[model samples]
Target chain A: MTQPTYDSLKVGDEIPTLTTPSVSRHTLALYCGASGDHNPIHVDLDFAKKSGLDDVIAHGMLSAGYLAQMLTNWVPQSALRSFNNRFTAMTQIGDTVSCSGKIVEKFEKDDEKFVRLELYSNTPQAQTIVAEAVLVLA
Target chain B: MIDKKHIGYNFPPVTIPVEEGRLKFLAKSLGETKAIYTDPDAAKAAGYPGLLAPPTFPFMLEIDALDLVDFMSVLGETLEKLLHGEENFNYYAPIYAGDSITVRKRITDIIDKKGGALQFVISDNTFTNQHGKIVAETRTNYVFRHQ
Candidate 1:
């Protein structure tokens, strides 16, 4: 895949959207092991139910990881200067997520080129996770 | 009600070594197809010193040295009511395999909302490499919901 050059990117350019496979219980389990975030709300169905949640939900970081993957897959890993997101809703198992972003601003500072983006992810149920990111380009 | 006194509490620092195998696992788990994240030769060809960590790889590092359960216990809250609310990361330098990074965490803010039914605990963490250069900073907010 060809990377986007600093010259090629401009304000209002849309990043290719990424749609993930359906989130599964097994995936959540693997994430629990990998992230060391063993909160029962993410793994134990009984615990989640008893706690008043509909079911075991995906870790917020897991969804954040997907959004980061979307960015790094397009730009070089080293080019990312910052990434942030607010978890607006729970990502339940069996939900498929789609991530999209658009360049909102472009500027030059200290002889370095930077692009700022407004990013977001949404589930099938219309729940959204909003994000903002800044990337440096050569 | 959330205690505002815990603000400014700092946790013990933890040093974590970035391992190549763990990097690969993280990439695979995230379904990343980047060769630089898992292939040393690909990273070298891309001008990196060694295996490259994915943008959010720092999430795998055990930076929260304080026990969440114990911390919540002191606050008279239970882990069952906790939820992740928001997260942010600022990258100052690239992290590569074989780098030992030290992380320091501090509680920066606590807010009570919804008439004390919901509380938020915000923490800021700094990551420094073996040479003592700051690599990244992360801010996280965890929400506690009371029934």
Candidate 2:
């Protein structure tokens, strides 16, 4: 996929939206190993239930990764300047997460061209994460 | 109730060695197909020092160094009632494979809301590379429910 060059982007332009494959317990476990977050609420169903959750939940970082993937897929890896998110809600297994972003501001700082974006991730039901980021484009 | 006195507490620093193999694994787990994340040559072509750690890859280093149980214990909180509420990462510079980065964590805020039914603990972490250059700062918020 060809990414958008910095010169081609405009403030208020929407980046392409991406829908992730349904999250699974297996994927959660893999993330646990890869990310080193072994929180029982994310892996142990019984523990999650005891913690007032219906079932084991996906790691917030997993959904955050989906948002990052959406950006890196459209922008070069080197262009990423900063990424931030608020995990407002829990993501359970079997939920398909969708991510989208819009260019909100563009400017030059320190002789660098940068674009700021408002980002989000949601399940079919509601938005689960809200984020904002700045990307440097060559 | 969480101890407000611990708000300014700082944990010991942890130095982590970023490895290419680990970066590859993390990228694979995310189903990332970016060559710069998995191939050192591709990363160099992209102007990185080596295999580039994906945006969220620092979670591995941060989480490993963070002993949650100990952290919560110090605040008079329990693990079972905890949930991740928020995360923010601000990058001052790119993190590359083979970089030995040091992470220093500190509790910055504690808030009780909903008549104390929920408590939020916010922490800030600073990442410094081997040369003592500030690489990134991450702020995390954890929500704890009262039983």
Candidate 3:
């Protein structure tokens, strides 16, 4: 995909969405080690039940990583100026996450052109995360 | 159970050198297929000094620098009842492999909501490269549910 130019973007342009296969325990264990977040609630089922959850849930950052993946797919990591997310719902095991984003606004700051995007990752059950990102446009 | 006195708590600084293998591992774990994240030659061809760190890669570094379980223990909270509420990052510069980064974090605020059933602990972290320049700053909110 060619890099998006500042003049070619509109306020409501929707970015191509990214969808993942159903989240699995194998993926969660990999994330735990790779992310350095050894929280038992994400890996230990007994612990999760003790936490008042039926089963282990995916790490919030892991879902955030999915959003990051979607953004990086649309733009290079270097163009990303800021990324933020609020966890609205838990992503249970076996849930597939779909991340979508739409350009919200375009502006100039410090003589650099920028675009703001409203982003979210959702499952069939709930909207797992909502995010906003700012990226530089060349 | 939220206490304002812990609002000013500061964690000791931790310095970690970025490694190419670790970056590649994290990128692969995220299912990233970009060459810039794994191959140093490809990264250099793309004008990057080394393996390029992904956007959310800093989340792991921060937690490695300061363990979240340790942080929760300081507040008298257990891991089973804690949940991540939100996360934010502002990048001022790119992070490449071989850069030694130091992180410093401090508790910024503590708030109670839902009639004291939920408590939010907000913290801010600053990451500085070896050159002593600020590279990125992150804000993280952790929520605890009182039973």
| Model 2: pairs clashing at backbone N, Cα or C within 3 Å | none
Candidate 2, residues B65-124, lDDT tens digits: the string is 776776777888788988888888887777899899999998999999899999999989
The estimated TM-scores of all candidates read 0.93, 0.93, 0.97
How well does candidate 3 score on lDDT at residue B34? 81
TM-score of chain A of each: 0.95, 0.94, 0.98
Assess each model's interface with DockQ, reporting 2 decimals per model: 0.70, 0.78, 0.88
Report the C-alpha lDDT of model 1 over B1-147, residue by residue, as the tens digit.
Answer: 667888998878888888888777776667777888878889889888878877666655633355566667767788788988888889999999989999888889999888888999998988899999999898888899986
CAPRI accuracy category, model 1: medium
When 1 and 3 are scored with TM-score, the better candidate is 3
In order, the Cα lDDT scores of the candidates are 0.83, 0.85, 0.90
Runs with alpha carbons beyond 4 Å of true place in candidate 3: none
**Candidate 1 local accuracy as lDDT?**
0.83
Model 2 native-contact share: 0.84
lDDT (Cα, tens digit) per residue for candidate 3, span A19-125: 99899998889888888899999999999999999999999888899899898887888899999999999999999999999999999989999999999999999
Q: How close is candidate 3 to the true structure, as a TM-score?
A: 0.97
In terms of DockQ, which candidate is strongest?
A: 3
Q: After superposition, how far is residue A70 of candidate 2 from its true place, in Å?
A: 1.1
- Candidate 1's TM-score: 0.93
Question: Which has the better TM-score: candidate 2, or candidate 3?
Answer: 3
